[model samples]
Target: SGCDTQTVVNNNGSTEYGLFQINNKIWCRDNHIPHSRDICGISCDKFLDDDLTDDIMCVKKILDNV
Candidate 1:
């Protein structure tokens, strides 16, 4: 499916830019920001502590829905 639109998120009032939306019970894209910045939360890595910051990549998110 193609992306509709994007929304920016200021994580904890920081410069973390992320795109996402919660609609129809679905949490859409996040930050749409460059992978170099912001930690995306699309998946749960039970193996990790999930202390990822906003400046990280949520590669799991992309893979999960794809």
Candidate 2:
């Protein structure tokens, strides 16, 4: 499904944020979650804006690992 930067969804106990719907439990850090890996190395809120630079960078980082 397509989404925008403002998109946020709760799936089971995990929350997905921003256009990529990045999961707080894995990719990005959310204050509410205590043990997130934060692979993106940035606040989850950074993805929730018009600028896609950080979002794209994070995606690239994610792609590199796989």
Candidate 3:
């Protein structure tokens, strides 16, 4: 029998049960995210996280937490 689980926090400040650890890391699918139009003042999570949405408004949520 194989069993594994952990706690993961989302941008909304919610905890999700994480399982199937891969060398102390959990993998999940990322959604579409939009980046800032201006590259100078753009503060999207693109540099840190992938684009989860094609719209800035949608990405804002992830950016807020991430």
Write out the backbone clash pairs for model 2: none
Off by over 4 Å in 1: 1-57
Clashes of 2: 0
Question: How many Å off is the CA of 66 in candidate 3?
Answer: 27
The most accurate candidate by TM-score is 2
What are the per-residue Cα lDDT tens digits for candidate 1 across 1-66?
Answer: 023223223453222223322221122223342332222334222113324342134435445656
Task: TM-score each candidate.
Answer: 0.18, 0.82, 0.22
Weakest ten-residue segment in model 3 by summed lDDT = 20-29
What lDDT is obtained when candidate 2 is compared to the true structure? 0.80
RMSD score of candidate 1 (Å): 12.6
Mind giving the per-residue lDDT tens digits that candidate 3 earns over 30-60?
A: 2222221232233322223333233344335
**Best-matching candidate per lDDT:** 2
State in Å the error of residue 23, model 2: 1.3
The Cα error of candidate 3 at residue 25, in Å, is: 22
Segments of candidate 3 deviating more than 4 angstroms: 1-4, 20-66
Tens digits of per-residue lDDT for model 2, 1-66:
276667466756777777877778778887778799998888888888888899889888888978
Tell me how many clashing residue pairs each candidate has.
9, 0, 6
Ranking by TM-score: 2, 3, 1
